[model samples]
Target: MKYKIVNINDTGVRSVLIIYTGGTFGMIQDASGSLAPFNFGKVVDRVPELRQLDIKLTVISFPKPIDSSNIGIQDWKDMSYIIEENYAQYDAFVILHGTDTMAYSASMLSYMLEGLNKPIIFTGAQMPIGSIRSDARENLIAALEIASAHNNGNPIISEVCVYFNYLLLRGSRSQKLRSSTFAAFESENYPVLAEAGIEIEFNYAALKPHDENAQLNVINNLDANVTILKIFPGITEHSVKSILSDPQIKGVVLESFGSGNTMNFDWFIDCLIKAIEGGKIILNVSQCIGGEVEQGRYETSKKLNEIGVLSGGDITTEAAVTKMMFLLGSVEDVNEVKKKLTYSLAGEMDMMEE
Candidate 1:
């Protein structure tokens, strides 16, 4: 699972470990014109420009490359193991992930890798590498360059980030917005951390400064007994009841309307009350891309605050769902879980007024 490509022209270059999980970025077409996963050991041959970046590169590929949609809890665990095992060997890490679930995986990774002191970038391509006008070369090359980036003898970026389509977004803050176009990801509520043009321009003030003395911790215990219920007009109490009917369900991310407002119906409120009384952790998140969940900003959401529904301020559903998994796995007390969800755990949300 290990292959090295030494840049010929550069001397004493920093190293980057590329973890290829599976995606269009590493695919090639055969005589039948169907896309197939390429042997990553031969990647340098497809993208010769890797030699010019002058970064010592090593790769570790999954035994079976899967579409981003197929990524699961086990895959997340395996990816963490790779990064943990090689934490000391490489300057930074770049994950070759599929575009479909890249944001979810990246957001989950942000929660898993707490107190990070080096960059863990996730990037992929809309077109296959073997295509005449493939974006894989640019994306992978930029990712490598950013991974090796350092300033004042310290790394420029020391957190989990998603570098895609010329922008570098905070991993948990980003969401995949498009599937057909190259502009597939966006961080609507947050500012861009970095951008690549003629040069890679970084917003230093936006970058989360890391504590070099802190320990690098990777979280593996995530409780997947969580569900997301997006509230729409006329969403039945029956549907909500059915979802919450399972006694084993630990947490739910209620994707409500703007500013966390929901249908202010008696049955709806009663349903929520029953769940909260049943010891279920219900987190309120705004369905809008650019706003925070203000629990008491209006009459509809005031009940959410009155009934112990936790407000997830401006946190995307990607982060909210995964955050629930992380918190539920670590803490057993429901009140403590509610407290943790109200605050920023790894910059996933703004510290909302409780």
Candidate 2:
């Protein structure tokens, strides 16, 4: 995929590549007064303050803008490819994406770009950039600043992150918790990596260590056959069976109740047992806001452990689902995949050894 550089200048300074994927931040109203995507070729025109920063800026926009809801595995691959191709050319990457699937994209990339040591910040706006009062300017400015931020001659934040509304959170650990509010994202089980106040205050203790030697290796083979099976009261056995019985499915993220508790019904346990025996990886993740999946924590969850369900400790559902896709495509052995599911590969989960 060929990408044109919009406003790149001398490499003597910190440079950030602004990846413009279609989102509200790039939308404007037409003569009919309906919101539509605006041409991002002049992105600096929309957010002129970008020119004031002590950094060189370049843009790579998608030929056809993609709304976040329509994002899929292919989009993830494309984004990775862009980063990999331009890894050495840019100091950082700031992806302008729709809020709907921003968390999912960020979570997926954390696993895909293993050993990445450069800042990759994803941000977008709740309202169009053309709106009388929009949050787009602040989000873009903060994200770009964080992307170019450095310390002691190395990048301060060297991992995948989502920067929105003044908070910087680990990509995989973040979740879009609200729909209508400015604070649309949250890292409930984990602390924010940094907060944008008078200046960007980075929590050095919370940053993930990087492998400088590994560079940017993008894993493109993501298995999309995984799904989340959230357990709710009176969820029919047939519904569970239909989900677990799919032969093509290699993994399932079971969104169990508080701390991985679920109905201890014999049929439910049997279905999970059958799936495990069939070589399907059943990942037990909590449905609660701030908790881990501790299989067998209570009587209801004990059967899950006995039946070979792997626990996902303090992992968000978004992380669990995307990580499952990454593992299912990468690992050939079911047992090895199960083991990796319980551990934190890219700081997706805060796993405590049992």
Candidate 3:
């Protein structure tokens, strides 16, 4: 795919490459008053304040923009490939993506790009850039600032993150919780990496430190065959069987009730046991927004642990699904895949105690 590159600034000490992959942040009112992708080559025209920051800005845009809802495995490969190809040339990266699936994309990218030591910040808006009351300007400006930030010649933020509204969140830990508000994303299980007030304040302890010796590794292999099975109050056995019995599904993110509790009915337990016996890796995550999955803390969840279901402690559904996909596709050993699911990879989950 051909990329459109535009140099917005060339004199600053740090250079940041902006990867535009269609989103509301890049939309503008067209001749028909409909939202359309704007000419990002003239990004400085839309946000003139970008020229004032002490950072060199360059944009590489997708030839044909895509809605975030349509983002898939190939798009992930394309994004990671671009970052890999330009790794040596840019100091940091800013990805302008749609808010709908930004967390999923960011979570997957955190896994795909291993041994990363530079910032890859994702940012988007709930409203179009052309709108008079749009929050795009502040979000873009702050994201650029964070991406270019460094301490003693070292990148302050070495991991993938999402910058929206005023909070800088760890990518794998973030979840989009709102649709009609400016505060659309939250990292309930993790702390904000930074906050933008009158000035940008870095959360020094929460950041992943930059490692200069680590080389970038971009893994393009991702299996989309994984599925999420959410347990509801009145869910039927037929529904549970339909998902667990599917042979093509290699892994499942079981979104269980409070603290990973589920129906203790014999049929439900039997279904899980059969799925595990058939080589399906099941990870139990919580339906609650802010708690860890305590697999055996309650009687309802004891059967899940006894039947070989893995606990996804405090991991968001987006991260759990994508992490399962990443591990299943890249790791050949089934046992190794199951083992990795129990622990934190890329800070997506909190470490469970033995």
* Predictions: Cα RMSD each: 2.2, 1.6, 1.2
Tens digit per residue, CA lDDT, model 2, 227-298:
889999999999999999999998999999998899999899999999888878888888898977777769
Give the Å shift of residue 217 in candidate 2.
1.8
Candidates sorted by lDDT, best first: 3, 2, 1
Score every model by TM-score: 0.95, 0.97, 0.98
Clash number for every model? 0, 1, 0
Q: Write model 3 residue lDDT over 199-317, tens digit each, in one string.
A: 99999889887789999999888898999999998999999999999989999999999999999999999999999999999999999999889988999998888889999999999
Model 1, residue 144: what's the lDDT? 86
Ranking of all candidate structures by their TM-score, best first: 3, 2, 1
Weakest ten-residue segment in model 1 by summed lDDT = 3-12
Best by lDDT: 3
1 or 3, greater by TM-score: 3
Per-residue lDDT of candidate 1, residues 1-354 (tens digit): 433333332433687889889999999998899999988878889988877777778888888888998988888888888999989988899999999888888888888887789999999999999998988998999998988999877889998899998999999899999888888899998899999999999999888886788678898898999998898997888898998778989899999999999998999889889988998889999989898998899999998899888888999999998889888887878778888888877777767434
Error of 3 at 80 (Å): 0.3
Please identify model 1 stretches exceeding 4 Å from their true place. Answer: 1-12, 352-354
The lDDT per prediction is 0.87, 0.88, 0.94
